[model samples]
Target: MSGKNVPFQDLFVTMTKVAKDAVPIGGLVLIPPKNEHQLLFVLGGTAKVQVDHKHSQPILAADTHFIIKPGQSLQITNQGSHLLDISIIACEVVQLSRADHKLSAASVKTFAYFQYETVSHTPRSLRAMVQKLQEPSTFIDMQKLLENQFLFQKLIYLLMDSHASQTDADPRHAVESTIEYLKLHYDEAITIEDLAGIAQLSRRWYTTLFKEITGENPSDYLIRLRIDKAKELLTMSKESLYAIARKVGFEDEHYFSRRFKQKVGVSPRFYLHNRRILGTTVTHPELMYLLGTIPIAAFSPDQEFPSYLLEAFKQVPKLNNSHHFDPEYFKPFKPDVILAAEWKDYENYDALSRIAPTFLLPSHNDWRDELTDVGEILDKKKQAHRFIRWYDDKRDEVREQLKLLTNNETVAYARMTQEGLIVFGNQSSRGKILYTELGLIPPEKSLLHIDGKILSVEQLAGLGADHIILQIGEQADSSREALLQQPGWRKLMTSPTSRIYTVGHREWYNFSFSPLSTGFAMQHMLQMFERGVVR
Candidate 1:
């Protein structure tokens, strides 16, 4: 700004809201679109702010402010139950001249090419000045000061000074840099001590911080990342499984296949078969999809399908009557076997057996067992094995991708209900995929428990996980929302690595128990993990 005065003018504050009601849990509040630049500050309450798909962050700390550039839409959602208070200061850039050229008066246009930044912590001098000006005793003085050009000049200079003093210093900086290194050299043999050396921290301290931030240990993270890369090559390219395995950091292809089977429940070779033929109506549509077969008819309690099952069920007829399965509905789509899960009523099993060779599928923690049984029943045991292999390949791919994104961070899955939060175990559901299948580390506290246990807010908060996957049920209300506003929940939100991811309750609860649900769940979970944080 080469004018006779400073580059900015202190326009009056445009809007102020105090103790504004919070948006309900899983609800969003949109900031009215504006064509003018505005300085928005999060005066109180923590929220998640998303400006389009590329810009999103948690507003947990106070005084978190960001510039709303012209033509930008801001979406602020209350991640907590407490009311969110905010204020907007509308400002203008003064008309200036530099070297015979007229400077744009529009603040956005003026800084169009320059990178705009935020001042999280006000400088000491500026803070003191603002405090003094805001004092009740200085009411008249403040009014007079606002009317003077000197006030605008001082503010402009202070902002510039603050920007100049900003430094790239943050706690996560080391971890982020080390992850970048890992991504670039994922194909190489890397070790925990080596990564710790990259961070320039002692091995124990580095490992601790890595797990605290990423949810897994360094060795597991590295191995998973390599396997993920190998999976991409196996699926998207024409490379042989052996070559692919070696390319992704495995020394022996046989060893790679063993590890892949243990983690993914299938061999790489068996996973490549793309199609399967099913001659009959199957009760487990999700399982059919997992086994690489499209069912003639699918049974669900209702028409509302989980995201994982949505695409597969689009054209398939639903053998459902409202929220229950009717044995009569199976008569229309008569053909082969009906795979009835043990979780459902078996009285109709005999009736279903009459319609077709209905096999009562045993419900189990390990989804592979269900898959194997379904294969055996359908006389596609070979195809089922191939599906498992395919699933394992996909699992490896997802694990690798997550290893890069999550590093050593751990993830915890919990469900919010009327009673309390339910901490899912690592052996089933999203927990199994996120922790066991995906190779993500669980918080030490979570390791002590198994799945299907309800936890108090204190337990959920104290789980010590770096990231949380909060499963929201269909019947969830304000009471469930209030649970998030608890002191424990607030503490979890304040951590540097604290991130809460919301997923539909139905999608996660039973998706892991069956092969059908597991396939879709694995695909959906991988996509979520790769996307990193959810807003």
Candidate 2:
């Protein structure tokens, strides 16, 4: 089986399953298991453990022993300065499985390699031993196994006994040991002392080792772990922010906000609403589903959502990765009836027609009737009719529940508009793109965070704004050219006065959806705008 398939519960595979002093950060470990496991001997210098907190004491030498039989857990920490060598090893848990069980768990000794070096590059003695292990009969000979075990034991003993003599030694072992403890007990309040005990070393030694091995203080790593968990939750759950904060070991939402902002560059709410802050006029459940998954992915060059739909239809778990922009992102799956605004997009997903019919959704919205016409093309005119009824039900529910929030009889739909980037629709939610794929900031009155200094009419024209909305007009420049360039008299036109005020306003300012809705309207309006049937 692939490593990705393995469900890891608090355990990370070690790069080196068997290692020596490697490097110590001033701590020794003594893992007192609740169950029995193999008998393990930790040999190193001064160490501190957390069985008793508020202390960082010295560790005993090779003479100290802890039986790590099957189903048992062990810990050792060594805190020293210069490369203090500490030795750690795992023995067969079968030998001590049920006897006074004190270890954590008993399972197959699954090891992982983060990195490794060739035996030829090892010390002279280790090189010779490795070469011997490669001999043709090594696997068949029982004596060779015994000899190999004995040699490994001797090597660990030598590294621990003599190499771990300095106060500040290599701290990789201590760092790794702490990582192990953190992985196991993230849900609990863990401290340096607890980690020290795991490594059979002193608190000071453990802290030092943690830094040496991980290149950061232990506390920093813990925060990172918490932040990562928070991110996963934000994307997957509809949990309240306070609840999520508490779940991630943050009791205060405000503090969590600060930390999350510092780490992720966005607030929790933004991450959650990035793709889904939508207000729709459609109320029918089936219609809502159809519209939400509009299959308008005709030009989604990434091919992402199509494949995702294919897998979803097949009940496969989402296979997304951190690289969200990968080009082949959506090639893995296929979909039926892709809502194409353009024929080009239809061709893009045409490769999957053998699997299912990929048709386009009708793209007209001058009034609501076009929706039915669009559905009719898919041979689902009745479905479109039913949608309006479903929409009414949802609209009534919203009006009943959220009536106090607004004074208007017609509900206002707010969401990021594609043209205005972060703009929200001010009119009704029905019959338009209620949302786009952009994060929406909740409506709150505050000074615009845009440029502070007001630009004059001439300055506005220089900046190339289609038109300008004048708060008040005051002239600073006397030049006629400058006055002419000023936009103070310009009309910032919108849909209400679109055609009526054509002389003073620009045509593009008549708000509408993307080429999608506009093109749809154009197709339907062709006869009205230019008499007769046209494709």
Candidate 3:
């Protein structure tokens, strides 16, 4: 009860009981007070224990222990995924007079309450003794009762030894205490040596253990905490950069700017404006560019840009290779914002966010909606709406021309790749322009919803369309020649009722998805219809 050690003759233990409990995930265990003290040991898993329904403290497996006083209620919760296993030893303790070695009647009657203390990292021998108490026993037998009393005495001795060896306790407790201190005083002027001294560990050992537990060295962790606080201030308040720098523990604004850029990939001023944008998808860069701002870097898997945007993006650095974005490769660019499409690797979002504020855009069937969302991110809502209106007006102009040119004829769009011939659906880039915008009918209703499907020669022969627009790939000339030699190709070409038009695969594939590219695709399709180059 007191910090001082109780003499061996000054205490008596009786009615000792040991119970083991298993609490499942998200389960709660309540231990009612029976006018007896308890020694709670976490055998496995972790638990949050609250005394009398007050604030709780975490008890880690095999590393912490609590001595609950008599008449104290306990509320234990298992917040982790696994079962929380704990052993509670309850016993009645009577005070004895130290001088005469006899029970103190007055002390027993008064039962003065004392402060409760936690004893961490008890000796290993105490675990075996507690486990022994869990064995089946007949309490009515006097021998068993005496055995329990003797075991309790040994347990008390082990507890005393734990208290005596406080200086040699687990270093984790000291390190954890230091971590709490750092969290509370992050903005204060603190040194690594001071933290190590507070943790009672050598500087090297302290840093090693800190990194092991927190995944960051002390300096980095502290700096990150300060930077996070600075970000909040920057967003919520109009504090001068120098004032913010001083408030978040940096003495110089220049040093703060450098650290902020290193951690956040942008200066404070750039963060507010989000000026230097990075695009993680091909469409994202085009959308941003159409919104009147060129991305600092963009994904260029083949080191090629859309023909319509090539001149504008000729100076932008490529951020990805073969459609794969490496966060390390783009760190030096220091973008203020990153626009990523949902099709990119979901796992890299966190890493990308660390470099800059990253927004993951979901796949939208309509490129206009994607542009509007990007506009919201860059605060260019008006530009996005204006572009959509321009596209709609252009689409209307083309749709009227196609109404007279095609005269209700069915049209199918296809692309020739090295693999084979693939047809596009109404929802696809080129397909949308042909079917939705220009109001062309597909040979079958199923093609209206199909995104993209590969067709064998047999399937191609059965496709009953008035006209077919085939885009030829750069390296698929041989494949195209082979297809032309097939019987299905000959039959389709010979049909006087059907017409076939050809276009460049590079021009159509790259310039068919984003707002700007879709506009180009419309003009390209109209030109092909006017030229009427049947194959």
| Reference-based lDDT, each prediction | 0.60, 0.38, 0.73
- The order by descending lDDT is 3, 1, 2
**Could you give the candidate ranking by TM-score, starting with the highest?**
3, 1, 2
Candidate 3 global lDDT: 0.73
Those runs of model 2 whose alpha carbons end farther than 4 Å from true positions after fitting are 1-174, 180-185, 200-209, 212-215, 251-258, 261-535
The model with the greater TM-score, 1 or 3, is 3
How much does each candidate deviate from the true structure in C-alpha RMSD?
Answer: 26.1, 21.9, 13.9
Measured with C-alpha atoms, the lDDT of residue 529 in candidate 1 is: 69
lDDT of 2: 0.38
lDDT of 3 by residue, 104-142 (tens): 222221121112255467566677777777777785877
Residue 133, candidate 3: how far off, in angstroms? 16
Q: Write model 1 residue lDDT over 1-535, tens digit each, in one string.
A: 5332333332122222112233555567776656666555555566677764334464633455566765556787777666665544445533334442322222222242123533355444554343333323333675654543344346445654454344324435455556655664577666677666545578898888888877888887777777666655654456777789878878788999998776655777664443222222233666666656677666553346666677766886665433465566667775444566666745566566556555676667677777787666544678888878887887798778778877788777777777667777765465666677778778775463576678877777677777787877546677577976788767766666667777765565465666555555666666776776774
Stretches > 4 Å off in candidate 3? 1-197, 200-267, 301-303, 319-326, 427-433, 473-478, 510-512
